[model samples]
Target: MRPYLFLFLLGIVLFFATCRKKDTTPTPSTPVVPGCTSLLAPANGGFVTTTSVTLSWNAVSTASSYDVYLGTTPSPTTLVGNAVSGTTHTVSIPATPNVTYYWYVVPRNTTGPASGCASGARSFTYIVISMPVSLGYHVVGYFPSYRSLADVPDIKFRMTNVVVYAFYQVNSAGSLLAPGSATAPLAAVATKARSNNAKILLGINDGSGDGKTNFKNMAASPQGRTNFIRDIMNVVRTNQLDGVDMDWEFPTTSDGTDVTFTSLMQELADSLHRDGRYYLSCAITAGKYAGGIRDAIRNELFPIVDFFNIMAYDDFSTTTPYRHHSDYALASLCLNYWINTRGMPAAKAVLGIPAYGRPSGITQSNTVLSYRNILSQGGNAQLDSAIVSAGTFTNYTIYYNGQYTVKRKAKLSKDIAAGVMFWEKWQDATDGQSLLKAACDTVGRSY
Candidate 1:
């Protein structure tokens, strides 16, 4: 072989090798495409409730902007939720409860989405409920609006439902008075609640002032029932209320009361339904017969109510030897009566627990005690399961639910009842230590 020819070929080979090396090591300033977009916030399999969901991602070094996509299917086909110039953007979408959605992001350069920047989609449900698969349980809390709406903001986040208490008076002419202690405008309360994905309920109490006899008169006649129903519908619609919680304590006390009560309930439910999905609930005595509920229930009037809240607490009777007023056994008895004897749907039965406990051996009947008072009385908050019902019982007279018992009851509700409810929200401890927090967490953990 000619030396000059071999050297020429070797030079050509070396030149080609050098060109390949330069091709492999591209210039840094040339700007490579943005990396794949990574989703943040709603993480993977997260849940959202509001119509507006804030989506965020780590901004790619070369990305000048981003385009988001969302839809009901697993692989979203919609586009351009926002032209996010930064790492985050809150996208507005019509979110429905108990519905799941899919979303993804695309990092883009000035030219368009950089090469290989299409991201994997993630899914999230609009609701964060942990109710059982077979059954749906609601966590209902009573917020006495008269107390103060300060807790509304925080309580709304921790609850699935809220009831504003004391729509106090129902006059004899079948008139509806604006119940007392509204402290804050009912509309504001309703708006704040809906914003947090929680339900707002209006509770009517008929035991005080003209609330008693006047209510009895209003409840005794057909005209009274009709007039009251019209008035209630007005109030509910005017305030954009989620529902009405009837607290007619003794609708069955009089022989004729049952007839009017049943008719009133049926008509009210029909009216609310006609207006679109409005809920109606009740605060009734645990006693089936003595409480005047057996007749009301036997008449099949309860079909109108979304659920019946059995006031399982206040076991205090005419006589007492320091009995467990809110005993687990007593609650069970009440639950069994509604579920077993009366043939009530477990989904429509809500077991009510008192936030406060009674005084040990307070020989007086109907002497009320609040959970806050019990705590102030040096009641050691311990979860005791020794009783027939699993709950936290501290002090001989105090039978309130601690975090453990509350969680247990929440779990039990999934099986035996529609859900467990508290008399009031203000009575529990605060932060994660609060009973409300415990109840919410338990539902999250189980569901």
Candidate 2:
């Protein structure tokens, strides 16, 4: 009995000792971040022709509100707007024309004190143009099949007083057109524009590549170019188009090719300007050289062309970790690069954005995934990627690592460019709160 008592006592003593030891293992903690998903609007710097330019953004989920700042410098950032709620807010700029102003937004919540959300600082140039005026057109090709254009108020909103609104493009390359056709859609677009009391800028841009593209040779060869122009002219005559927008995917970098391309543009600009019946426009690259070509056009063809829209999106991959296309800063940099660095006029510089987004995790092996399919089960992990359209590729591969998927929201705000352009109107969100519409709203312009 004594031995059993001794053993029981020893066991009790050991348990007490174990319980008395202090635990040293660390507990998991939440990430110490000022805010999450605080964004800059206009994704690309947008056009402004007013004493005031609006700045807006999607609100941070954990943020109770936001603080807006503006200054010529990044540090000692001057406060402009404060305590803005909802997902978006607008800030006004009363600066003079062509002045670059920097801005940022901060998030505040109960979990954290009011802290700087300090987004990637963005900037834009301002000009004094007419009030509530912007220059652009919505060219929808994937419509009715993708979404209805009538449901898009952004298209009809600013378009009310504006001259041009929408153009239903008949793709000469893809399913948009049969072997040789443009008249049907051309007539349809014209009728709709007339009904809306607006002008339809005909889209003659062919996106088809080397093979299986009828317009490929047309853009590259002299005879083909001539014939293509004739076809476009015929459509203009038949539909009474207000103007023609030649969207040749790209031009030749070959020797003497530059001269030919310049000559072609000059002739088109000259002929169209002389007609006195219509306007001429071209969609050019968003790079530095675009400014050079635009200068040439202005010198030789500005008399005929109404404007040259710089297609600014599609710079980076949406699937990659780096933010692509509509990067707020990248857009600003491009605008500064072109206008300040390369020397292009702000009035003629219409910036382009994409209403569409590229799938990041979608690969060759497994391709189909909607916005729903890509979200994480817990919603804690977001497949972060930049939102922008690719320059000339159907799709790219994203490596499967922890179920990371990214999609682009190519909207614009901030201080940026003159106007905005989306690749196609049909790709706009169902609610009309799409990339292009967002840009329009930010700039206080409609549609």
Candidate 3:
């Protein structure tokens, strides 16, 4: 064998070895097109109470990202989110009620997007709340004497049709207790409320102890009822109030107080309605749970009262996934119980929405944080539950209705009830994050 031939063969072997090494390095392969995602939330043809909605879909295996499209038409030409990495996309714009909205999610990989995604688009109807035009919707707020009047925004007074000056206590004998230090504040608030074109009412309730015992005793006898009505009217006249709101915590059927309660309410309504210029309202229980507490508000008193403020908050359920004290579900149930089960008129049903939230793992009465304080302590406005440090506990998960839920509830009120009512006006935030403002905005009421 010649040296030149052997050298040439060795060089060829080296060249072949280099080529093999190069072949060992992996070559890039084209990515497979992702499968179409399945829409999960806001079920097709379903109704959504909230303006802000979260659009969610089942993740596709090969999907690197997703494109979300939403619009009024079936095809949904508007591109809401592009290249969204997650399976969910929260709608940033507020949805209009009574409008049908269509959405499409297109799963995509490096190769291309899934085909026929728009053809399989889903749709949902934003509920249209038909509010009465004749009577006009009422936004009622309870102004408690304990809270500083300055904390309440001036816009709140104007937003509310009725501002209740809470709790001028009543004795067992049906005589009114002195306002004492609250008199000046009451007068000031009443004056402000009246100036804002809001009807201010004097709220009467049983004093400190014995729950509804004082109210029960007062309403039991004719003389006591007469005395109570007289004092209420006198107080209304003195305060220049438009009417009276009876806050009898509860008058149970088991004790026969419910019977007397009807009589008392009838008498009060007669006296207040005589001039045809005053309103008579009552703060009733949520009626979510079964018991004497629910049956307290008898059906007979429906016609006697102008409106019943259904206290729908402070609900506690151990079996629920999240222990939300004032959840939207509870509000719906309360309204159904009042208007459907009990046969109360929809126009007279005023749903109550709390301005405060209760912490998880804590009793409803044990811990309550106002919406403003919750936001100040790192509460998320978008999410319903927030992890925050409250009192001795660190990283406590507090469950409350955020701005979204408040707006949802307000919309719910317009759908089936006269209006929405807050437990206390001062509990709301002063800024744009104000729960009152959210509610008013949803109901199309300017604040």
Candidate 4:
């Protein structure tokens, strides 16, 4: 009985000893891969105007390095960076305009790359930096009273040789109408123009209601013309402006005002030139089809005015297949009509371009949109037309002079015209994609 007891006790002790040895043995653990990182900069679906873009991501604790993929497609296969130790990488993309690019970053460790990182990919649209165009050409920009004065940048003043404030109303009595609430705005712009050494002018157009009729009646009478010249001079003097820009939409032969239009301009020119400091310019029609109205800007008045802002964009030729209100062909024809056909001096012809775009279809709901708005709505800066989707149901195409067209026109103007003029300065994009900038660049003017 005693021997059996000893053997049982030994067996129990050995069983306990074996259990303790097994518990003391160590077991290898599985390694942890890096967690997914968040993307930063050039936010998803954003626009970048520069050639080089910096891509960055949030750092992960376990990440040993990062792998970068970038390409034109959604699932970017091109690996730009392999095992990059940093959290950011700058890649030089193509300088092409309006190109969409996609990119993603994968955090990696010795264990492996972070899973589900492909879903974190992002996209951006690239807009090429606008290049400089030409030198020794004038750039004229019109500023309407309705536009905010704050919209006009200091750089714009530097770009323009002449800036016209449009417009002060003209009453039937031939007296100048004040711009009312626009006084402060005008004063602000004037100060900016003076500081930038730019010539500023006050624009005159017919008043509201029977304004056209009043303008015609006033111009027909000698007394009315005399009053107009005197009142306009007084206003120009009060404003300390460089000169006046006359925007008589059209003086038709049917109304018998076409003849009076020349006489009025001639008289006004005489008064302005007598001062010796003030300059004179007139905004004339494109002369494509407005019969006597088009013919109204005769050769007799060409020598009187300092220059003619050939309103060359509103009317398109009948031969065009597309409804491009202002196209390269129209610009050429208008220049020809003014310089060659009308016998006006090439130096006196300033080609006019629109800073706004019209819809491709004549019946489109939105008649016009500013060039800035066009680009904001996904309009390509390189192309002349954009297919815009306004809402879920509204989709239309807008036609305007993109950077390419603007550069081309500016080059053409340098060849034959004095300079280029846009309708309103505020309508222009205030960036690298600005049509005004594109024109200035193409003409070799520094802004």
Please give the clash total of every predicted structure, in order. Answer: 2, 13, 0, 9
Name the regions of candidate 2 deviating beyond 4 angstroms.
1-184, 211-226, 288-304, 318-320, 360-416
Q: Report the Cα lDDT for candidate 1.
A: 0.66
lDDT (0 to 1) per candidate: 0.66, 0.49, 0.82, 0.81
- After superposing candidate 1, which stretches have Cα over 4 Å from the reference? 1-135, 151-157, 207-212, 288-293, 317-319, 363-369, 383-399, 445-447
**lDDT per residue as tens, model 1, 140-237:** 77766665667444654447555545554575565777745477557766676677666777777664453346666777777777788888888888
Q: 3 or 4, which is superior by lDDT?
A: 3
Report the C-alpha lDDT of model 2 over 54-165, residue by residue, as the tens digit: 6777656667777777776644378776666765656566656556677777776655644544556776656443212233433222212233445544354333222232
Highest-TM-score candidate: 3
Cand. 2 Cα-lDDT: 0.49
> Model 2: how large is the Cα RMSD against the reference?
29.3
By descending lDDT, how would the candidates be arranged? Answer: 3, 4, 1, 2
After TM-score superposition, the amount by which residue 416's alpha carbon in candidate 3 deviates from its true location, in angstroms, is 1.4
Which ten residues in a row are the worst by lDDT in model 2? 400-409
Predicted model with the maximum lDDT: 3
TM-score of each: 0.61, 0.49, 0.67, 0.66
* Higher-ranked by TM-score: 3 or 4: 3
Name the runs in model 4 displaced over 4 angstroms: 1-136, 209-211, 316-321, 389-393
